[model samples]
Target: MEIELSLPEPDPAEQDREVIETLINDSKYTSFAAKYLREHKSEIDQLIKMKTKFGNTWKDVVKTGLRVPNSKVGFYATDADCYDVFGDPLKYVVHSHNMRDADPNAIPQRVVGGDQLSLQVSDACKERIISARCRFARNLTNYVFPTSISPKDRVAAEAELKAALDKLTGDLAGTYTKMGDLSQEEQDKMVENHQLFHNKDEFLVKGDFYDDWPNGRGQFHNNDGTVMVWVGEEDHIRCMSLEKGSDISSCYNKATKMLEHLDKHVGLAHHKDFGWLTSCPTNVGTGMRASVHISLPRIKANMPISELKDICKKNNLDIRGTGGENTGFAGVVFDVSNRRRFDVALSRCHY
Candidate 1:
């Protein structure tokens, strides 16, 4: 049929007026709400009064199931669909986007992507301009009232604020553009790889041996040059034996004896800096727990699960869920036990 369909062009001036109006109204309403809250003094009672006074205002601004702008992904604003425009118009207007199929590379991407697109500014340059305008307006409102400002004064301040805000918003947008964004996953990985240890000072471990090799002395130096020493070979060996515990009781005994010897020989001043070296809430009653990284793939699929549980129990090892409860996702648990010793220094011999 040789017929073409086209959307009508929006009036630029009219749209600009609408955006200016929205920003101004938002500022005014917010100021009014703030003043009301101040007057009420009691937040709970004030909130109840506000809800009653502006119940219909909420309905006009918000729509059901509509996500508010700038609220972040996977989360919604409280009472998002409710209007209460006087309360926080900035929240409502900031999220309002009008652009269909907004480009990711668009100028002022933050503003255009969601509810921000509804502003009167140009598609190419408006987002930043509007953001600047909004910021300036809010700042001016705060400046005028300091305490007792009227809603009309706040609205009047928008034009002056818009100019300043636009400039600042543009500068900010440019900065953001220069710093290319990384995906959330990449950011998480970077955070996870950050260094865990911060202490660089030396620490001492001391203990007395009770067995044939009593009076054994050992010292461990960390990469940071921190040193810890324990007196007595049996105490040192008992500490090392934490990983080879036949039962929890045996592990506890060795850990306790090691600590006692350390206290007697070196004293708390020497090794107290090391968190693991001291008796804390988690390891207080049990000392340090040794954990072994095990590969679960070695276990046969057809083997009876009950036998595995019994074997673990006999070995004095606690069975733990890797991914899901009872169902083994990984072939083995990272075998962890407390009642054993960790060789702090390779050069130091255990009792």
Candidate 2:
């Protein structure tokens, strides 16, 4: 006798079945993302096939469209203000019409970017390495995800950010160049600078983000390349500051100064409860990351990669190869960084 089996009912509201199925049918989902969703189908409230302005959304695409993975990834599809639109969890509901509302009493800003990131990585440290970096993602209030960000929106936003950069004098003074406007030679040089990583984002594979080829993407950096802001790289803006050693305060100051200036003049995405808002949930809170690169010759020589990675994982640390993730490690140097971005304070990241 044949037996009938019952499958759990799917959540109608979790995801738009039509779009999810369509992307799957079209082979737009990454093997990793598709496989991941399929394996953990239960934890997912919904499988959203979202649209970004430039690239496709990946959670560790939030890496986050909720850049997913990295210990805790901010799933963009579910957490996006438009997708789920969760308002202040306390004053509002999980998926409200608006999530940008900020509380009056909440701190206007988190850390003073430049204050805490001033220390330099010492030469005498056990690992002989110390560097600090703070990166942030910002979204505009008017646009949907990057998928739907209109050309007009991209141009206007770029102009606004560039204008702010122009206003700054001294180290912050610089020019904003659009990807579409650069000459082939300049573009090649930019790529060879070793500053910008090749966009190997999985979302690009899934979403065809390069369809127009540099429609609105651009970069803003100081002459020394110390202060750089990637225009339309991941989110609308990837504000970053790099420094040698562990002077996190200096790094934060450089990046935050730009963000604050823009926030005051143009505005940024933020919520009272969630702090900063982005396509990735992991990036939502303070929208800040502090990282250090340590050359652990002793540790690398003594420990296996698997074992060493495991130890870092247990302690809320993230590691990347010396040459970054895709490329193999460069000798013994490794990119070690904090694991959490939400709720956790900036100071704890250093600890």
The top-ranked prediction according to lDDT is 2
lDDT of 1 at 314: 60
> Number of clashing residue pairs in every model?
38, 52
lDDT of 1 by residue, 130-162 (tens): 111000000111122111123453333333332
In order, candidate lDDTs are 0.25, 0.58
Question: Worst 10-residue stretch by lDDT in candidate 2?
Answer: 88-97
For 299-345, candidate 2 gives per-residue lDDT tens digits of 88888888887988778777878555466666788888776555555
Model 2 Cα displacement at 343 (Å)?
A: 1.3
CA RMSD of each candidate after superposition: 29.8, 9.4
> Ten consecutive residues with minimal summed lDDT in candidate 1?
130-139
- lDDT, model 2, position 57: 34
